[model samples]
Target: MTFASWQFAVFAAIVFGVYYLPPVRPFQVQLLVAASLFFYGYGQPELLPLLGIAVGGTYLFLVLALRDRRWLPVGIIFNLALLAFFKYKFLFFDPQAPALVDIAAIDFLLKLPLPIGISFFVFHNISLLVDLTRDKKAPLPSPTDVFLYIIFFPQLVAGPITRAGLFLPQIEPKRFSDVQLVEAAKWILIGFFFKLYVANNLNEMTSHMDFPFYETLQTQDRWLLVILYGYQIYADFFGYSAIAIGLGLLFGYRLPINFDLPYISASFSEFWTRWHISLSTWLRTYLYIPLGGNRCGKFRTYLNLIIVMGLGGLWHGVGPSYLIWGVMHGLLLAVERPFLKKFEGIKSAGFRALRIAAVFFCVTMLWIFFKLPNFDHALAYLAGMFRPSTNPNPTKLYYDLALLYSLPVILQHLHLNSFFERRLAAWEPYVYGALAALAYLEAGPATAFIYFQF
Candidate 1:
């Protein structure tokens, strides 16, 4: 269930209530593992076995890999196979067809809907195998611990992908007194505010950016919607990550921080470092370094960058638009590399501001590909951004509403919100209370978290 829903609220409350009882302390990991299974199964019961096989099989492979380092590559390949089969198989075969593979079991497997968290859990599996195996002397973890690590409910679906090295050692019986209630409250409150009051409201305005609907927008409105979408996506994802982090705190498990002020980044590489920090870190550690990273010659490094980014793009989906989006990002990173030191040498605020604007503009524009997955539609939307509107009737947008809803993200990125928060330190509780009220009262039409599609 969605974090924003009443059902989830009830579910979380029930789980939380039983989670910290004196009697339940010893069974914390087992309780959480069961709760996580229930949480995943609630929405897609049919995929429960798939989830089991994924975790169970990964655990089995982990056992083998630990005993024989030679099996490490085999374990990694097994997880990759699962990811590739679910993520890219549709590109080659249509499950909708009547009789492509007449075998009932194989057809059923093909027809099975993509599990919601396959991408994320698969990554967790790989991390488990790699991180644990690397030590060589680390003791084998219990099956229950492995299950909890892979399927931890907070970061399971759309993740601030916690690495195995970072997350595994944190497993222990937690005390109620140790809960960071204030910090958790702050995270949860800010997350809900962003998701409901900011992202959801902006989603209404940016809905016009969808494929056919975008064709009716005025020229300037196209650009405007792109900026709003950039904000909305940030709010949506940051909100989810924040909530996940906060929930992890409640459970005494700390997930990684997923975002910084990414929009203020003056370079594409800096932007990646700030945005989706966990995923970028994952790619850098597991993929880029393994591929030789920048240790090789410049040409090889550039090729490695492109390859990693292209695969990163394909990881989101098998769409051409995703590939183009990723490749373009890679190109930007490569193009900026040689000039980075020179750019850093400039100390002027105006020049820095200009660079930030340029980076933000490019990043926002690239989001067009994400907004419209169809290559032609993405190209059409980009084309419209530079041309005059030709539609006989253009969709109207409320500029006042747009500014009001987007003010938080803007102020946040500028660090103005921090200034105000410090200035009104004594009124902190009241300000957050007001935000909570406004989030509930002003929340817009509900939409699924965007990254859930992955």
Candidate 2:
């Protein structure tokens, strides 16, 4: 069920009603688990077994993690293998072709449907196993709680990717605090507003624009589109996280937050720290740390960073674009490390602002690759971004609203980036009000989240 649709609103209301009834605590937990299964299986009922297998397989992996430290490596390998089969079926099948025609044949023959948000789910499950490895003495939970946490519908698609250790333990009985409920309601509403009004509307700006026209537009306009895209995605996705975290709270679960005003960061490292905190934390703890992290030599540290970030990039999609994206960040991180010390004492305000602008521009450009379907398409889009203007049919309302819409991010960047960097907490009221209004607004047709297909 899409969080943007009335289906989800009604779903949330029913869940909330049951959750508030004092006698429904334990049953509500089980009901949520069942609802989650229905959510995942509702569309693709044929593949319900895949979820069951994942749950059973993960449970088994955790069991092994407790047996021997070596099993941690083995279990992870198994999880990766499973992920590869479903997520990388196209990649795996590529070599089976004798001709380009054979590629079509293979895709047809495989009949594999990529599980919705399989990437997010795999990472979350992997994190659970890593947490087990970290605390050798951590007691195993009832499989039900772990199941509930992992399969919860809200974060199942695009995620905050809450660590099982963070959420699973919090499922105990407690009265719903009024403040928490109100806060939860606010987040849910904010998520709806972002996904619907801001992100959804901004998406409409470019949806109808022909590629030929977009390619010929002035640099300023193309750049505006790109910036708008970045904002739309952040609002849509981070908003989803807010709703998910809020819903988790409604049930007495405190999920870790996903975003922290990422645009405010002056550096890529800082940006990752703020954006998708849960995924970054997962990569840092499970992938980076396990790969020896910075504990090894400087060169190895750089290599490890690249490897993790590259995998992190690939984790978003099973494509060459994603691979290059990961490698690009890896290279950027390596270059930034050497330059970090020198830039530390550069106290010139103008210079700092310029540096931030350059980085933001660069980052926004890179997002073009992520947005595009393929590498060649991205190249064409880049050409459009820089090319001579043909018809400069600027989207005035889009431009106006986009700039106005991103004011919060702008303020946060100023405060957090200083002279521009604003503390993330200051937007609390806006977040609440936006979400509440979203909940009250009539939900139009359901539109799937971009990441859900991953």
Candidate 3:
């Protein structure tokens, strides 16, 4: 279930109450783990074994950490195997492949429903193992701590991808701080505005311009969708992140900030440093650096960056589109590497704003690669935007263009960076109270978060 939905709000309220009660203190972690499992299973009950088996086995492996750290590799491999089986195996070969006729379990494996947050869970667990191995100073969290770490519902679906090292230590149920409570309220309100007002507006517009209708739009109508789409996804995702972080604060936990006005970055490297900071960092730490980071020669570093990002792209889905998206970002990162010096001097308000707009548009253009099913569809949509046809189109909502343009510049600029920090610094309880109310009123249909599908 979506955390932004009424059902999830109800779930969180129940969990929150039970979590803080003194009598339930000792078992709170177990309660959370159970809730996590229940939450994951609520929509797709059939995927229980697929998620449970791995989670349980990983728990066991970690419990045996002192005796056999060696088991970590085996455990990760086993989890990856499960992930491959359920998420990636069928995606490897197209349905039309001649080799498909020889398979027996192909139908079962291919058609199996994916468990929500499989990638997040598996990767977080890997981080746990890596921490245990690399930073021996790190203490292994209690079973309950570990359980809560994996199960925290906010980031569970589409995540800022919380880390055990960061979250497990905050396992105890503490009294709510007035300041944190207030910050949570601000987050809830701001996030609500973005999700409901900004993102939804763009989404409605884009829904009209989908494949069928998209091919027939006039140039002006076509560009309108691209701009709207860009705003829609940005608002949708970043709005979710803000709310998640806010909710974390209400529970007295601090989540790492996710967005940093990435569109404002003057260069591509700056964009990577700012956008989806969590995933980028995760990939760098776990995948790139280990594979031979910049310590190698320049060319090797670039290769590693491409490889890391390429796989990172594939991590999003089992399609060439995602591969292209990943590669495109990688290439952008590569080319922009040497141009940072040129961009560093862009400081005037007018120039900075223009740079942000340009970058935002560029990023939005790439987002087509992320949102569309394939390159052909993306090209068609792009084509439609530039060349109008008399053919039919989806319910295009050009009326929302003015609102969408103001989104990134006005609403989005509200939380550039250190937003969480600034709220915490303010430390007012009323903020969180306001947030709780907003979350209550802005309830969605309880759709699973977009990232959860990954």
Candidate 4:
């Protein structure tokens, strides 16, 4: 169930109540495993078996690999193949080719609903296996811990993808202190505000501007829509991560932070470092470093960066737009390397602001590709955003609402960058309370997070 939905609220409440009870506390790991399985299977029960197979198979291969290190590739291939069958099968085999009945069989496979979080969990399993092989001194986890690590509900679906080493230790029993509980509550409150108030409202406000209709809007209005969408996605994804981290803390675990004021990043390299921190870290460790990250020559390093990012983009979805988006970022990053070295000594406030603005503009512009599935439609929207047209003017109400929803995030980034750090910290409770009230009053209809589709 979606975090914004009443169903998830009810589910979480019941789970937390049962979990904290004195008698039930000892079985916390088992209870959480059951709860997490239920959470994952709530909407699509049919996929539970597939998920079980992935988990069980990975665990089995890992066990075997411990015995005969040669089984490592077997384990990686098996997990990756499972992911490929569900996620990228369509990318390789077209369903509608006007062929014989054989093609119809492939079409049926294409029609099967994709299991949610396949991308995330597969990567988690791969990381676990790879880490085990790399660090032979590390002991193997029990089967139960392996299952829990792969299927923990908090970050299971859209992850700050956890590493086995990082999360396994937290499976032991623990009690939450009042201070910890308060901190967790604060994070949950802030997450709800971001998702319910800002992201949801902005999504509703811009929902009508799709494809052909989006291209028909005035240049200025389209630009506004693009900019608003950029924030909408940021709020939606960041909101999910915050909630996940908060929930982990409530249960005495600390999930990794995902976003760190990415919009204010002064370069594409810095942007990647700040945004999706966990996934970027995973890519660097599992993919980039293995491919000879920057340890190779300059040309190979550039190629590695592009390949890693391109694969990273494809990991989000099997679409041309995603590939283009990755390529764009990779090229920007490659171009920025020399410039970054040259500007390393220049740290003036004005120069930093200019650099931040330039990076933000480039990043936001590329988001058009990320938002639109059809390449031609993305191009048309960009065309409309740049060229002159006599479309109807957007209402002042629209402008005000968009600005209102977006301003808090901008201010949040400023605070994160230490613009008003002391003042914000002093007024923290009042600011949080105000945001909480606004969220309650202005919350739009419940919707799934944007990252859920990935």
lDDT-best of 3 and 4: 4
Q: After superposition, how far is residue 255 of candidate 2 from its true place, in Å?
A: 1.0
After superposition on all CA atoms, how large is the RMSD of candidate 2? Answer: 4.4
Report the lDDT tens digits of candidate 2 across residue range 259-293: 88787566778778888898889889877987999
How does model 3 fare in lDDT?
0.71
**Model 4 spans with C-alpha error above 4 angstroms:** 92-110, 392-397, 416-421, 424-427
| Per-model TM-score on C-alpha atoms | 0.98, 0.87, 0.85, 0.94
lDDT of 4 by residue, 1-454 (tens): 8777789899998988788777887888888889899999998987898899999999999989988989999999999898888887766655565542367765655666788888899989998898877778878898888888999899999998988788876778866443288778877888999999999999976664576667456667778888888899999989999999888887777899999989989888999989999999999999999999999888988888889989888888878889999988888888788778777689798998999999999999988888886888888878877678775654233788889999878888877526554657888778788889988899977788888888
| Tens-place lDDT digits, model 1, residues 1-454 | 9899998899899999999999999999999999999999997899999899989988998899888889889889989999999888888897678865879898888887888978999999999999999988777889999999999998999998888878889999999999999999899999999999999999999989887999999999998999999999999999999999999999999899999999999999999999999899999989999999999999989999999998899899989999989999999999999999999999999999999999999999999988888999999999998999988989999999999999999999999878978798899989899889989999989999998889
Q: Which rank order by TM-score, best down to worst?
A: 1, 4, 2, 3
Residue 354, model 2: lDDT of: 74
TM-score of 4: 0.94
lDDT of 2: 0.73
Q: Candidate 3 residues 16-87, lDDT tens each?
A: 777777787677667777887888888788777776676677777776764667877777787678777767
Once superposed on the true structure, which residue ranges of model 3 sit more than 4 Å away at CA?
63-69, 92-110, 177-179, 345-358, 388-396, 400-409, 414-448
| Global lDDT scores for all candidate models | 0.92, 0.73, 0.71, 0.84
Ranking by lDDT: 1, 4, 2, 3
lDDT of 1 at 326: 92
